[model samples]
Target: MAQRSRVRCGHGRLVALAVMAGSLVMTGAPGASAKGAAGVRPPGDGDTPMCRLTAGPFQRQVEKDLGLPQDGEQSEQDCAAIRKLQNTYGISPADGYAGLVSHRAAVVDWATRHKATLTGCAGRSRRLVCVDQTHQLLWVQQDRKIVFGPVPARTGMPGHRTRNGSHRIYRRVEKFWSSLYDAAMPFSQFFDRGQALHASYRPIFEDPGSHGCVNLRYEDARRLWSMLHVGDGVTVWGTREGA
Candidate 1:
């Protein structure tokens, strides 16, 4: 087991949170609460509501709130576009929602605004463009191009393998703890449950070790952290076969 530490997000652009005032006002609908209510669930709580909200209005509202592109309706194409955007920036969508949901909207908005692209190659900052345990690699992009290289990395062991799906750089800390080893260590924010990308002292990369953290070079981790901000995207591509 290894010690885990928090990754510092540092200072950067301020991510704007959407105004929930309008949406918070309940219409007294079936699932909605009355006016001035605080804990009201929306129209679709446990059971999926009868009226499926169109992706068009939702997308429009998201765009208007986050100042991103209006990608038409929430068709398959729109979903794919959103997924692509999420992958490029490493954020996830809701289980059944079309576009980026409330928590992930800020990240998607930032990636869209910065015009960051998803590439098969590597980044110029010596960042790890990790898709999964087997497909992880060190990469750099120069002149707007990607370059990749094979580098050692440590991933979560069998039962505690790094989680799959899209994520974002939410809150970051300077020091973190490894629940598996109960030691202090360094880490970055990619998941909520104490998972991170950090530095490893041993040859853990050659073998599947670590509770749920992604072990990388100290400098590499810092560089990647600096390049990222809260709400930046993070897409973990699962096992190598699919990545």
Candidate 2:
């Protein structure tokens, strides 16, 4: 959930509801972990068996990305490899299912590794925060050199889609609480209206997306907060998949 006014506010009511719904759906699933953010369970929660090759929607892409047998089918090897990617990127459930979040995570990681050739954001002469909604990633660059990220990010979903354009950070709060949504928006930095780049307690790879914000991992957001100033330029481009 997100805040209603300027200055300080929480994440978002819709976001909290989405997270709650996701948690409830997985509450009793096998290998669920209750210690995840907001009581949502992670995949490798406990003594879960290995090679739970549940067929995910993005099975083929994940298989191809991991250099597995590209048959678009699940297997023990696919499960293990996909789960490793999920764990490395902090995707919840780590269940070895190549769902949308998992697929996006893999794609972002690939983009990060090859960011030297990626294009979109301009202003190489000055500090810029680049948000690529198409790939669901963000990074900082100055004088044509990357200073931070190419990190995984989650942007607004279909309806509350994040606007693409040039904006500047206008406000910041280390620990913002949204009374409207009753959730914490840690390291909130407002760049456009109520939309900011902030840390999400929920995994950033979760579905339904943020409420017109650029959601980042806690560590990523903290690092970004330290690197970006109040007036740093932010340029967002591309279209979010479902938006």
Candidate 3:
């Protein structure tokens, strides 16, 4: 039987499931905690949380991406816009800082805007998972129309670099227990050999990367689990930086 998904979201933007904070248990796959995607807990309190008043490193780039004054300076308007984007993508602290994660998410969003042309990955006529290692991002498209992602992803690194090529999702395990790593892999969808797409409880941008799987944020992985299934076309290309 096909797994019933709790949420059905659209492309460019998807609903992020609540995740429990400080619950990560690493099991060797750079994976997430056992809380899974169903961990329902709201972040912070109040309608407007306290914003980061300082300018982030990616301040200028994010300003341009959000169509704000490209002054490379943080402003009230800039914080609000950046925070909105952060909230939409489940980035924590959502304080409207143009930090690396926020900037990366913005870049991914910008890539999918206005139905922009995505250069790599095939299967235009059918469900296709596009992995662009150059950008450290992933997105799903069909009929040349993006259905999901352009989300931040951490692929294999260095010696364990993920192999690039066309493949298919051969298996899916909602909560896979990895004895090899003594860890838990949530929303695991195997596409090639031991490599699968799964949620990593730790921050997706953390260093050293995954063993071979495409590591997504827990919220992003949950959304991806809902969007993808066994047999979907998977195309991975480009070299993961430093790999």
lDDT of 2 at 48: 52
Q: What is the TM-score of each candidate against the true structure?
A: 0.40, 0.79, 0.66
Off by over 4 Å in 2: 1-10, 13-46
Cα lDDT, all candidates: 0.41, 0.74, 0.68
lDDT of 2 at 153: 83
Candidate achieving the largest TM-score? 2
Better of 2 and 3 by TM-score: 2
Query: Is candidate 1 or 3 superior in TM-score?
Result: 3
lDDT of 2 by residue, 21-63 (tens): 6743442243322112312223454665344544666777877
Model 3, C-alpha of 95: deviation from truth (Å): 3.4
RMSD of 1: 15.7
What candidate 3 gets wrong by more than 4 Å, as runs, is: 1-50, 123-125, 203-208, 217-230, 239-243
Could you tell me which residue pairs clash in candidate 2? Answer: 1-11, 1-12, 1-13, 1-16, 2-11, 2-12, 10-177, 10-178, 33-41, 43-93
